[model samples]
Target: MKKPIILFVASIFLLFNKVYAQDKFTLEQCVSYALEHNLNIKQAKYTQAISEVNYSQSKLNLAPTVNANISQYNNFGRSVNQVTYAYSNNTTNNLNYGAGANWEIFGGLQRLNQLKQTKFTLMADQTYVEKIKQDVSLNVVNQFLLTMFGEEQVNNLTNQLKVSQEQLAIAKKKADVGTITEADYLQFKAQVANDETNLTSAQNQLEIASLELKQLLNLEPQQTFGIIRPSDAAMVEASKSAYEAVYVYNEALKINPSIKVAEYQSLASERAVSVAKGAFYPSLNLSANVGSYYSWNYYLPVDPANPNGPDYRPTFKDQYNTFLGKSINLSLNIPIFNGLQSRNSVKKAKISYENTKASEVLAKNQLNKTIAQSVADLKAAEKKYASAQISFESLKKAYEFSQKRFDVGLINSLDLNIAKTNYSKAESEALQAKYDMVFKSKVIDYYLGKPLTL
Candidate 1:
């Protein structure tokens, strides 16, 4: 049993290892995969599909209705014969079959208006699908940037660990030669350990970031993947003032999916009002039916000499010819009163239309505000990047000087560590500023109907 359990565990570990195999993808691949597989996007697609079906069905509703029916019955003594429409004390059998059609020739144009309303509602649903895709794309882009940032942070820590390891070796040599104090050598060793700890933490965070990205793509937790980092020159360097931002906002308004959804929904609601008003007018309809029927009575007798059936015992063909019928009708239904149903319906539809119109206004307003805020954030991030650049450069120079002094036993480990720490912090902050600027710019571009890229 123990052997079998061990084997099972080993196999499971191997399977997990296979699942964790590494792969790399570019930004476009990430966004595309998320768009195709994200649960939220898939759900939105389902809604769009349902709307498409409903639109087709609504168009079909404009056609006439047709139905076929057939029935049969048998009666005992004292039953009325269906063929004669008279009562008799004799067994009888009857059969009936027919096809009928009905069409609303006119219903205050409600059918046509309802079709238009369904069409507009379908358009709204289509726009909603596009909006969900855009949202997923934006989310993927943001998460991809964050993962890259975390990966770079881990690289920085790894480099710092290497430098700390080198310092520890130098401090050990100096202590052996009695040039550096034992306490100082021990401190350098401790700094190396701390660097290792920081590297491990940074790596864990990078892994978490990668996992979050995989979740967005609807991948399994054990799946392993990496993002292709764009080179510095390939990164976008978009610049826009408030005026340009406003122009972009106006351009976005022309095609934004969310705004389109609101507009279409409002139109659909207006059509609904028209449909409700139609209920107040008279409706016209046309109907037609054709059928054949038969009946028989076993109690009746047949005459051989006369070469003819007795009364009430007719031939099947003769009975069908006698019972067959065809008719057409035209009807008009003028509405009188219905407990104020039509009035209430029109009122409710009007209110719904007003609400949808307001929602459209809100959508446009929110879009404008978002664009303006994004522009402001981009400018702020630009300034931050410049300041961080200056700070990192100065700290780099100071740290280099500190490293030289510490190598020659002219400075304590504490002083050298302080300089190293400051330099690392500045590097991290600078990188953050750079990415923030890039992300903000991407958001503005996204709103401008530009393809999302690194």
Candidate 2:
């Protein structure tokens, strides 16, 4: 009864989880989900976790290590009693136990350097995790914009199909009344067919965009969810000129996780050199131990002939109280001639530090170039958008005039079709420019550490 009840409850919980996973995601929610689920981000988090563990263990390394040991022995011939260093010649049931601790008091500050280096590396790893998340967020933003654009294209094509179908009906009526040529009616029919085909294509594009968005979100293909576009108009009208490119780039330099990650890595490498140089100096360590042991074949310390004596074999308790031992030692290890491992390590660390410094330089240069290109492209797109808008408004008026003229038999089918085609081209070009400008502006926003949306 309990098993069945538990299974039913578990099934309900699983169903709830599945439903929640398919729930609609806002842009913020989507970004959060990707950070949680994206494989690259997950791996970066794991890497950061490993660095954290190393950093913590390095601190523990500064403290002493203690260990315990125990053993028993049987000997057919002469063998030394490990605990007392006495020779015995019979099978012996014995127990020996001890605990000892060793601590390195000084090692040219190597442990300190290691602790610092691991801490820096851990911070670098953490920053890299943020960098990976930002990358995934940007990708999600790109795909989100594409999906919305594709959906709008679908709506445009649907409207175009409706208008062409209505025009074809009017052309059919005119042809039946002998007011227009059969060929003209045929052109209207062809226009309707073309619009239908375009609508289908737009729908297909929308589906493809949605698929890409789902993939970026790390969602299963079968799961379904809706997206919200709360800032489409604002995005389209965003002006890069409002913010200076160099200022934005400089702001990115201050906050970008990739740069911080590189800087930390370079610092960690510098510490690595210190850790390696530590091996060139002498090390000092302190150690101590206290131990007591007993033999099973030995009796109480009350008899001499019977393996029981006050000064000989004794009970476990008597042995511990009377024969317990303790020792402490201080040792020093001086570096002599070994294979030049220390020198090579120091050399490798310096090289790594140099490489990290170079990577930081490269990252900064690339970011500057990318921002400059995006800014230039944005200005050009702004002009293009202005031109396309003007062209679209003019073409729209021309198409409206042609439609009225065709209805009153003042224009031929070719003239009407030409106006319609030009209008569609102008509208498409204008839309392309708008989205281009939107994307370019959003990039600057991304670099400036702003939220990505719409």
Candidate 3:
């Protein structure tokens, strides 16, 4: 009874393990996980946060500044009473405290320009973060799709293994009954060995695909999971026009995060030029403060109109006073030449502005080039997929014929093997073409601003 119970428990555990091991994973879940945990996306988010702080600083720069200060000084030296306040015999003490606020009235629009430039910079940084997100999503989609295709291949190989095993059994039975030659039975045996090898190879490829998908999702490499095919089959219809996708991509260039960033940078550069030119203009600031001070003194005299025998007296009195005052001061500064520093600044700023414009143009040109290349690739993949369809169909027919002939001894193992190889090659090529077309379609959709969906 103990042995039977132990065996039952072991079987139950094995059943549960199999169920757990075979749990399915979908593409959307994988992508979501990656977005949350991927290192590159996290880094991009940090960069955007830094840009936000910089922008806040730029805004705060325009606000008024207030400061308070207090100081007390004591001096003891040779005293002089009627001349300089400098201590002669002197014990002198002074105390002062004040509060002031300074608000910029004008600075040739320099502060405004600085604010504008930083705002544009912040926009650029944010766009860069979005671009990183889009890139990560694209990568995740590709890997996820590849894993699906790999699963399909593994299934196909398993079916082929089953067919080979069945054929080997038939050949073995015929040999036992002396109806088939030893050489023919040997051929079937060899075919079974090849099929088993192929099955092992397929398993290995499946593991590799699973690992790659897990890596993209930032999951542990040892994890095993199935991927559900999320998207439709590759588009078999050719594009209506070669320029259609290109036009869409061109539109995307207008809004593509990188291009937008470059545009913002150009504006920032223009603002920079204005800031630099501010050196030629003057600035004004207003400041005011209200405060109070107090003082107390005690002295002893040996002979100072003295009554009471060199009188010692505590004549210190508590005196307090408070007053409110206001002042508006105007400062005028005319620009004086300082080694042509202002002129050099303006020149450098103008050069930088020009460079920014050049970069903007370069960015646009690169965008156009990228679009053109992607369109070409899309077309090529479309054509390849069509060719692969034809090749795969023809190879399948040849394989079917070769299989029948080998069973009847009309074809040798070598011929059958060649046919099988051709079929496998054609099938793989067709699958690759299918995936390529899907990937290109995604690129087109991305350029067209289409949202990716399950």
Best candidate (score: lDDT):
1
Model 3: per-residue Cα lDDT over 11-106, one tens digit each: 999899778667776656776777888888889889889888988988898998888877755646665322133445656554445677888888
Residue 306 lDDT, candidate 2, scale 0-100: 54
For model 3 the TM-score comes to: 0.78
Scanning candidate 2 in windows of ten residues, the lowest lDDT window is 300-309
The pairs that clash in candidate 2 are 303-308
Estimate every model's Cα lDDT from 0 to 1.
Answer: 0.86, 0.84, 0.75
Candidate 2 — which residues are off by over 4 angstroms? 1-29, 32-39, 81-88, 231-233, 299-313
lDDT, residue 44, model 3: 87
Tens digits of lDDT, candidate 2, 380-428: 8888988999999999999999999987889999889889888977887
lDDT of 2: 0.84
lDDT of 3 at 132: 81
Candidate RMSDs in Å, in order, are 5.1, 3.5, 7.0
- Single out the weakest 10-residue window by summed lDDT for candidate 1: 236-245
- Ranking according to lDDT, highest score first: 1, 2, 3
Query: Is 1 or 3 the stronger prediction by TM-score?
Result: 1
